[model samples]
Target: MHGRQLCVCVCAAWFLAANGEDVTCLSEYYMGREGFRSVPLSPLVYTPIAHRPDWYWKKIFQMRGIDPESVKSGYTEAWLAFLFVEAQEAMTVCSIEGGRYWDCILDVRKVYDLAQGSARSTFAGRLAAVFGITLAAPDPLPGHLRLSLCAPARCTESQVVQEIFPLAVDMLMGERPQQMLGNASFRDVVVAHEVAGWHDFDIDFAIVGVNRCGTTSLRKNMELHPDVVIKGDEEETILSYELANRLLPLKAQVEEYNAQVQERITAKFKATGHRPHIVGIGNPLLFQSALVRQKLALMPQLKLVLAVCEPVGRMEKIFMMEKYCHDDLPAAQKRLVAWPYRDGSEVCFPSTSALLTERHGQLKLFWDQRIATAQHLAALAELFPSRLFVLHQTELRDTPSNIFNELAAFVGLRPFPEKIVFRRYNSVGGHRTDLCFNASLVRSLQRLLEREYVMQESILQAFRGIRIAARSTRCDLVDKVDTTYCPNMAC
Candidate 1:
């Protein structure tokens, strides 16, 4: 148990007298007790409901435009509607940039005017009509140019417009949140049947871990390949945390996802008459979830990818996200000098002194997250030794095409169809680290690495580019710190 779960699992013990002998009854099992998931510390209760009948689910998929079996050829230039299949009512503001891979950024305005006022150009017409869009139909009205959908129990349009839409837009587009505010270059643009094409394909692999460690840029570059189709949002996924931690025993959602994957194969067979070789996603946070073992148990053939960067550099990225994940960088930068570790920011951004107390636990947890990667890797090793691939961020940044070619070869993916021009979407980390670095804190942080040393070392061996407390790395205070506690520390 990492000891930071927010679920309220209330337990109380009552002493009872049964024929003069004291007997105890307890409400819940404690951590490390039997019947608990060892890693997440959540109760292990995965009783998949018996398959009663799924005759209607296919119809539901067809109705939702997820199963595009009926759409004929020449529908190649079709659009993807951002569907909220579950919600009864929703609102979305969708903006589109055309072509194979489009650049789109959505913003919810109290109302903003279009670029060409009242002009009759087709793009402008579409923009004017969709500016205050409302999605009421469970019936998906997909056409040539749509990319977002949502339905939620919102009290007022004001509530949906002002709060929910922007949050959803930011997440769906950035694959990470609030990053759209700074970079206009982040996108994975499709989430439905029309534009994704009816090519029968199986998910060949999963990029599961080391979040904030170049997984975003990695997923983007890989997606650029003509052979790859990212089924779900790489940044925020329906397949990662939601699939792993379903707090209810109602049903296993993976069954439906598995069914959808299978249907894609069947759909492609009917469409092009040839099955495609690959479809995959990167739900980076899944590497640490209780679902790791559960997923392997279900899809044992699944290949895993972990992006590794120097630990401290990874933490510095973590620090940036914690401080500014919700706010845009320009606006956030304005607030920086005024409120260093401001009041409303995430808890981890506590003042420098707290680095010894509250921040100590936070920093420890961050490294523990890195340590947890070892546990997942060990499990993958036992299951299938050759199934896991480690991609180092340093290598990816320095020589984009070469590292991509190596990963592509490992995963059976074709090479990039064009010249590999890699662009990083998050530039906030390039700022001055003097704003948040403390040498003692970094040294102490490296001390915590001892717990996961052996496991981390094995992974480092697998990927030579993996650096530990190296002065050449991008971490906040590596050069400034007097010493690194990690053994064999080198650039």
Candidate 2:
């Protein structure tokens, strides 16, 4: 699978095993430049986390004290070197080639008989970029090129090698390869993870849905639930993509996700000593991908909370968002990724102001966009009715206390404190509190609300069990008129 399979031959090595057959790395099939031979396997395992660990190594420092944090974080090369000086094994395996250490990040023979696939094609190029050395193309089986990298201040060698090891193993083993070499970060968390019976993420819930809704506030409330661990920002852009990649197989994606998060959540567990049962990402844009409508399908067991408001209000809030709020947006749209729009085709503007100004003409695009999102929501509800929850943004704004407590129970977590304060993380009705919709927009907005809004009891058709917030989706128009905020102008 790694390289070309030449003319078929009856080789005993190719005989079927329970899992799969062993790969035969042939020299003629494998491509290489000039003559490259075997390089002995270097003993260097995980790269030191800190780059300048050599600086700290000294017998003089032994008389003084070593920093425990530095050692724990893999920056104690000085202490380690002092210990290993007599053995000379470490010195034999590694060397100060130039000014910096070119630690052996890859030895092709250990994982495979030959340099193949990504290791064959791009490994040399990547090593050159990172360590600044152009290498001849490596050969097969007998050996090719070995890639060693000199890291900057931080060592990403463990991450880079770990990605390669698993993918390349499948070619040799025929089925799959279990990573023999452990990531230093992964090693730190394995014991704690097993003890806690936790997977990558400990918590059981996620807040996935409409922007400008109370998704932020809901997550914050959950964090206050006595024993909970919520990592990173309100939007988990990294973790969300892994969960929603339509192209990648679930197992492969999960293993990669595990490799990443195996360190993240469990590290928090180690620090806090409280094994939080409530740990999950809260990203509002999870279901926005048209290609992967079933984003929640990635974690089917996960209890999903989607907070949605009346369509007009949500859009209006974004339109009225303070300029200061859009401060982080770039001056010009460099790429489609600048905005987390559904896909590459969607119009991307630099700022919220630009989006509102340019795309205001496509106001009725609201129904198409939201209705499609609602369909995605409906599909998830059908699949995991007991697990999927639709939270009414109107209700959350109305009765924050009750909504929070009930939501905690939904996720099988304890409620927030009885006297705890509930604050809105995102609420922007700055420009005009009154509705400014014309008659046509008003009618369209209501239909959008009734079809999708949990408050109207319309979405309840799919999700029967949820905390309902009784709030009036009605406000007087700014044009000296009274028209309802919700669909069908009812309440």
Candidate 3:
């Protein structure tokens, strides 16, 4: 019989015996129809037209109570059809093959294994084994017999076939194409798999700054906006650290860091019709050059937000928090004594008189160096002139709405909806003043502020000079103007 006639005879016999219903085979039915050509299995190049035969074969298999996905060769439409017809004949239609189709099926499967360069144990193989039939070793077909019904060329060399039924192929083969065998490199595959099933996005903005200076609150308020997606509650410290250290390849590191974040932001985008204009993460320690350089390299257009506060208040809050956590005064004093200073100077726990008189200037310098103020912000501004946004911690606390509006404009986001309410989050509740430090320590910190006046003024003067120069150029003054000196100090 001709190829189409043989296929129809086999399919009709299998269907009648298996399902007790007479259905015309797809190839035979469409043989003479216009624009309908049977997909040739001998050459085995999977094309879009091959789906028609695969769909018909799936229906037949489903009618016979077999899951197409459970079959090993189900990925290739032609091979799956051959397996289905052969397995049906061997198991159910004994009259057609005279109780010998089991051997025939094995012969075909061996050819398939040889062509594909791998052996796949199938449901059909298990069934044949139950019938006490042992499959012969895979043998190379003779040249004259190579184009037989069990031809090797019918199953190999076409990834398009594997892609057609990916889930079944992945399940059977125990690997995904995108994760293991795609044309893309291993790194590309890994990155693609990490961000799979989500919309792609980039980190557009970041709030990088002082830890106790309302960064958490700012992040919370920003998330309330329709166009913003902030990934975590506080700092993504490890990611920032990795960026700073170059601990891994840049692309791999970024993908690892942002994979979960992208999923979260994508979920937000799906829930609301609004796609995020700004997706961000915050880490207070990102002010370091290494971290900043990596961030700018990845996204040169990234907008940066920093929060500033009165240096003494910031230091006091930190100290009070530490004191409250560790009640052992002597241990706390020891830790302070051992604390590494940027300038490589050590602070000894001082007596009240010593702090009040002689050691005062030394303590003041230590506190000043620890405070990231005008000098640090100015350096950041120089590097990111158009991108840096500075918010005073006091203003953010007092006038949140206005500050948020300005922040929105700076990051190129739409104004927050009037109905959206902003709530203070991660606030250090209650008074830090009630947490008493040693009287001498308080005096020492106060004096430290007093002594840093000249240096602070010089830094502020430098910032003002930049601001004045910026006014003449393209720089927009979005940062909060902080000209007023601290009331406790002489300006």
Candidate 4:
């Protein structure tokens, strides 16, 4: 466990129990002794239940859009099965007496609160209902109130990690509490159909983002091992294609494109099962849209990893990279498309400056979008805190070697066998960093990035409260601005 986590637990126990809240920890097997306090009429009995029968569950799985036969091939099967087992156990003690609404609501709220470490997305009551916990007489807890209660319940994180984590992962991944139950049931069917296997991976990492953040580089460096097969960039693009269909009514051509993307990704993963490849998808665009996050959640054991850099540098790189990624247009055509810019905004230029500026009302829009990303990361982190690692691009420049090692450790992979080397160069010749970046432009961009970072840091700190403190290492070089303007050449 992280040292900060230990301190948080000690602080919480001292505050809540000391303040007369009857927060009982319940099971010694899972919750241990210290984190929970007791209430009168709270039963001490705990009963564990096996997953539901396969015949009834198979249909339930199909309803949730999972094919039992296909689900067994990936990690999703084991995850769903574990969730079913927990749901069964939770349903048993949903209420103190016989499904008493207030009692059961409190019970489910406490468990999920601590387990999720924050207010669940307006689904606390519904989630309770899934475990057969009903609310009566008392009002359903306000979203924020449930959140406050849940935040403190994070004291039970270690217990959740050890025993109930996989189930919780399924629950969070599901569309609703009841939907999660279905997923759990399907998990059982898949596990039984597959094998009597032991030792499924408890932790896994996902490179999550809004695309163009060096997710590809992160995955490649981390997946150098023969055992690691990171998914091709196109596979991750399937989620985007899915989102595009939902956002805009697709023409037949677009629909065909989406089908191709999905088939390509599905086939790629299906082919890699022969070797125990620690599969990762680099769908950096996933962070931009809420729908993509929801779709990804269903595929359990995903650790959302985000790689962030200075807004200016990231925007600049993104602008440069987009030309290559979407490179069908000729140079003259691309120039024509970029020339008619309103407020200097063009598809070719990184338009993200509008999103990253520090103007008050404008800042809030950026804050909302960033906060949404953080929330997505937070939910995944709550499910598997150790699995989620947010890396900053500055770290790569600072301690490239250690960053690689840390990344290797994070993704459950061994680092490169050859001595890893850090190469420092931009698209423009880069023996010197200053030669590439205009001093005035760099200063302006740095200021903008720092402001944006402060806002992002605030949101991240609020959720996980883990601040990464790494000293930035600087390379000395002469400050000479490059004479070249934007490289107008098409990839």
Top candidate on TM-score is 2
The C-alpha lDDT values of all candidates are 0.43, 0.44, 0.45, 0.40
**TM-scores of all candidate predictions against the true structure:** 0.46, 0.47, 0.44, 0.39
Instruction: Rank all candidate structures by their TM-score, best first, as comma-separated numbers.
Output: 2, 1, 3, 4
Model 2: residue 48 alpha-carbon error in angstroms: 41
Candidate 1, residue 215: the lDDT equals 74
The prediction achieving the highest lDDT against the true structure is: 3
lDDT of 2 by residue, 283-316 (tens): 7776554323333443545787877766565654
**Worst-scoring 10-residue span by lDDT in model 4:** 190-199
C-alpha RMSD (angstroms) for model 2: 19.9
Flag regions of model 2 displaced more than 4 Å: 1-203, 239-273, 290-295, 298-300, 319-367, 430-441, 447-450, 453-456, 461-474, 477-491
Q: Candidate order by lDDT, highest to lowest?
A: 3, 2, 1, 4
The runs of at least 3 residues in candidate 1 whose Cα sits more than 4 Å from the true structure, single-residue gaps closed, are 1-201, 236-242, 245-276, 323-330, 333-353, 359-374, 435-437, 450-454, 463-472, 475-491
Cα deviation at 299, candidate 1, in Å, is 2.1
Residue pairs with colliding backbones in model 4 are 23-37, 24-37, 101-134, 114-153, 209-284, 209-287, 210-284, 211-284, 211-285
lDDT of 4 by residue, 10-94 (tens): 5555665777743443222123222211112121111121333354345445545766665543234243344433332332333
| Candidate 3 lDDT tens digits, 268-305 | 88999777757877876566433343334335567888
Worst 10 residues of 1 by lDDT: 88-97
> Which window of ten consecutive residues has the lowest lDDT sum in model 3?
190-199
Model 1 misses residue 264 by how many Å?
Answer: 8.9
Candidate 1 colliding pairs: 82-148, 82-149, 175-235, 200-265, 200-268
